[model samples]
Target: MFVRTATPEDWPAIWPFLHRIVAAGETYTYPRDLGEDRARDIWMLEPPSRTVVATDADGTVLGSAKMNPNHMGPGAHIASASFMVAPEHAGRGVGRALGEHVLEWARSEGYRGMQFNAVVESNTRAVALWRSLGFEVVGTVPEAFDHPAKGFVGLHIMHRYL
Candidate 1:
C-alpha cells in the first residue's frame, strides 16, 4: 500500500468507517452521533495542514490521517495528527505506515516535534503502534475518556521529537 494526499472524492469512502469508529465510542473523543457534514469539515483539512489516504495497489483506500500544528501561533512548531483505519484492515500495518509518513512529513516541514493530545489508554493497539513509531506517554488525564466497553479511562498525551 502507498500513502497519498486525499481528495474530496475520498470522503464517501472515508466517512462510513469514520462514522462506525466514532459511534463505537471506544477510542476517539468525537461525539458518538457526529454527523457527516461536521465530520467531513473537520477531517478534510486544507493546506498548511493535510489529510492523507493509504490505499492498496488497486487504489482502494484502507486508512486515513489528518495532521497539523498541535496548537496555534506560538505553539505551531509542534505537530499533531489523528488516524483511522478501516476495521477490516486492522493488523495490516496501515496505522504504522501512516505514522511513519506523518513523521516524515513533519520532519520535512521543519516541525520541532509531534504530539498526540488524546490517545485513549485502553486502545493498546494504537498505543503500541505509536510507541513503535517513537512516541511516548508524556502524560495521561485520568478518567478523561468514557470508553464504551472499558468504563472511564485515561487519555494519554503522547509526544516525540522530530
Candidate 2:
C-alpha cells in the first residue's frame, strides 16, 4: 500500500466510506447525519493540519486520516490525528500503517506528542491498537458516547509522548 496527501478531488471517493462510518455512530464523535460540505471542510483542512489517504497498488483508497494540532497556541506543540479504514480492509494492517505514517508526520512537523481526544471504550480494536502503539488512557469521560449496541460508553482520552 502507498500513502499520500489527500486532495479535494479525492473527496468523492472518500465520502462514501466516511459517510457510512460517521452515520454508523458506533465509533466517531461526529454527528450521525453530518452534512457533506461540513465533513469535507473538516477533512480537507487549510493549514497547520493535513489529510492523507492510503491506497492499494492500483490506487483504490482503502482508508484515510487527518492530522492536526491537539489544541491551539501553546498547546499546539502536541499533535492529534484520527483514522478510518474501510470495513473490508480492517484486518489487513492498513490502520497500523496509516497510524505509523501519521506519527512520522507529526514528528517531522515538530510535534512534542500525540493525543486522541475521544476514543470510544467499546471500540476495542482501536483502543487495543492505540495501546499497542504506546498510547495510554490518560482520562475517561463516563457515558460520553451513546453507542447503539453498547448503550452509553466511556470516551477515552489517549496520549503518547513523541
lDDT by residue for model 2 over 46-69, one digit each (tens)?
A: 677999999999999999999999
Candidate 1 structure quality by residue, lDDT tens digits, 43-145: 9999999999999999999999999999999999999999999999989989999999999999999999999999999999999999988999999999999
RMSD of every prediction: 0.5, 0.7
lDDT of 1 at 53: 96
Cα lDDT computed for each candidate against the true fold: 0.96, 0.94
- Judging by lDDT against the true structure, name the best candidate: 1
Q: How much is 89 displaced in model 1, in angstroms?
A: 0.4
lDDT of 1: 0.96
Count of clashes, each model:
0, 0
Candidate 2 runs further than 4 Å off: none
Count of clashing pairs, candidate 1: 0
